[model samples]
Target: MKRHLLLTAICIITITLLNGQAQAQNLRAFMQNSGFLSLQTDTPYAETYLSVPGNSIVYKTGANGKYEGALEVTLLYLKDSNTVAAFDKYILRSPEIDDTSNITFNMLDIRRVSLPDGVYNVQMQVLDINSTDKEPLTLSQGLNMHFHRDSIDFSNIELIDSYAPTTTKNVFSKNGYDIKPYVFNYYPTSVNKISFYNEIYNLSKMVGDEDVIINYSVKHVQKDAVASNLFRFSKQKAAAVNIVFSEFDITDLPSGNYLLHIDVRNRKNVQLGEQNVFFQRSNKNSVGELSNISLLDVNHTFVTEIDPDSMVYFVKSLSPTAEMYEREYISTILQKNDPKLMQQFFYNFWQKRNPTEPEKEWAYYKRMVSYAAYNYKTAIDYGFETDRGRVYLQYGPPNHIDGSDREPGAYPYEIWQYYKLSNNQSNIHFVFCNADLVTNDYALIHSDALGELNDPRWRFKIYNTFKDGNGYRNFDIDYFRSTWGSQVDQYYGK
Candidate 1:
């Protein structure tokens, strides 16, 4: 069975403004939760983190005559039969502001809940208390927490924004440190380092006071291999509870999806236990060193065997899996129109992924590209250039697809569900729609996957519900509530 450890949930909220009429306003917020085990107490607990931008909410005069925004946050953990296992409901208030227009800070909240070892469905709801909207934003996902008492296990990795020696015992304090949770798994250009906290339990039972090696590294999601420069290891004595509070300098890390792995190895160099968390980096300045490509020897290599024209097409097909910097480099190589340069770059790309089997890697990817092209080609674009094709090439095939072409009051839409993504994400979904209807090409409008398009007003586009004067799509809550013959919500939720 797979474990559901770190989960990042995104919710879209509809706030109703009251001025004798209800106006729909949209707000987006992020929520993340992780489960951990307390060996000392023999208990399991969960930590929930929420981040809501202050400017996205409405502020009203408070009891102290100051403008403030408040959100009523609720969390519910349900069992297999839909029975509530644990729940929490509370009001999270933002800092008092002198002017609502200047509200630019994010309101962060943390909650800790104790739960036993079991699988659960977690539901979260958030509502702006100041808004007249009666309905709140809600989202649900799965959660699992299981740690055997006699076997070595790792707690879910918690990404940290900042940490210092604990001055007071608070909800954020853990293992003598006051750790601020980095709610999002996304790290933009401004974030230069990645810090995390994790715990290993029952090590003493397995190793019996023997010294073990703790190795942690950042691995590229596509290559499934550790980055050469980002690996580290340390020696420690096995104990009942071992803690790892460390960080890696990601200043030079390129923009791509990656996994941070924590592994425990026994004294005899045997594997014991491992845990990994997914994250995305966006460092636009750290482009691939294209100048180094000239130094690579492509003579007699696999790329030399391909015709010049075919090599260009093959290089273009790499867009789905190429990093931001690599894509930029590929464009340069294509513009240069140098066969040797393109072959060198192409061979190097596959070589990085599979040092000993670059040809095998390219052969397999060539097959996938051909398949995607054959199935998803559009009128003017190749299958790889289309949205659905791009997604298929990038993430492989979906586990299930719910496609509807004749739904009432809605465009042809399809919801593709992936039971699990290669990056360790579970139950991910992608929403695609064909508005023109004539073309079979389905454009991706929304997705719950990290680093993909996430449009809160996706339903509006699919249903053709409402648009403002400027022809911009706007979500109409009233229409959604009264509309008939639309099962998109049901299909998407499933």
Candidate 2:
């Protein structure tokens, strides 16, 4: 009797273990939660497959009368491999089942769903749970996702600039739209870039429903024709947008021109429109006026905090953006007569920021200031109070800058392009300033000689006045340009 009891216990344990192995339908759960599962499908006729939600009753026809049944399903995803190990899975909503009779296929047919543009994989399975016979069925397939293209139209469908730097309005459409502005940056002398702001309107219309795409580029005038970087986008909503492109700095570019090419497409994968903007960069440049400060001839007295040569470049860069009085200070006092003293002055300026060594954030700061001075200087101040100044002050000069400048009053503006920042981005823009003539027009034209405005705000106001004003009114180039060559030549070129 004892031997028989032990044998019965062993048989029970063996049956339980076998039942667990036969019900090992866990691959479905794995596919549902992993990155490999993708619901996106581009093909319309493609069939889908999925396992039943659980080990619930999914009966099938059998050979005997009293409704003998069995459960088994097929999954294509597992067909390639000889054995099923582990896999990710997802489930479509199962249909409510009133009866399982004659259930030839008891698995859910998997269908593809729309997903954002990216990469993914899919899988499905069928479980067997009847008649104590047959293996489970499973299927799976792989697919790639491409964004859906929807359509968007500018409310007015008119090509016009409706906004300034600080403010903009899209009045043509009462409902509103999407517009993004892209700016490109280039070297101090490159003119091949055609800088323009691209407006992407009506993006909000497709935001959640579909994807919107736009491609933008630029081409140089020469046969070598270096093109602007390609830009892509998806639109799904209505949004007003503006993108600025900067391929070169206006100040350093030669007088030749370039072309801006904009190609726009929508969610339905339709090309909405294309725009060609002709941009030219010449040599005559104007920047907002900047403040001028006089320092004692410290040329002979050296400061150790900052290097002397770097200080000179920093100061020279600022001269082009200074006001008339500031220009006079730079030309007469800073650049012309006293190189030694100027170096000491600039060296001390940075040393004040860097009282300690190796903690040199000042190197980046000074380079940005130099960049602002070089690109924003006007006839009076050079290019100083530009978007470049704000960015330079914010993040410093980017890794690269492409530049170009046009004669004042000839093309109405200049531009600077910043490309490939540490953060992986690009920008471009037209530079303008009206502050040069605001306070003391030039040192020669200063209304007050003995008591100059000591306030920084007054200096900025003078600068803004030049930046905001048109070249026909506020720009004066004679005192500074005379040092380069003939002032009359520049004046006529403008």
Q: Rate the local accuracy (lDDT) of all candidates.
A: 0.78, 0.33
TM-score of each: 0.74, 0.21
lDDT of 1 by residue, 73-114 (tens): 888876542557787889998887666544557888888888
- Once fitted onto the true fold, the runs of candidate 1 whose alpha carbons sit more than 4 angstroms away are 5-25, 63-65, 132-134, 291-312, 328-344, 351-364, 376-381, 385-494
Q: Please give, for residues 1-494, the per-residue lDDT of candidate 2 as tens digits.
A: 00000000000101111321322223231112111112133221212323233333333333332222233333222211222322334333333333332233323332333333332223344444442534333332232222223433221111221224323453222114322221111212323233333334435544543445655554443222433233334333334332323333345333333444455666666775554433344433322111222343344433344465655555655432222333344555454545555654455444444546422645565566766666554454433444445445433454433222222322122222344322222242212223333421122111110111111112222233233342312212111212222222232222
Model 2 residue runs over 4 Å out of place are 1-198, 205-290, 295-334, 339-359, 362-419, 422-494
Model 1 gets an lDDT of 0.78
TM-score (C-alpha) between model 1 and the true structure: 0.74
Report the error of model 2 at residue 135, Å.
82
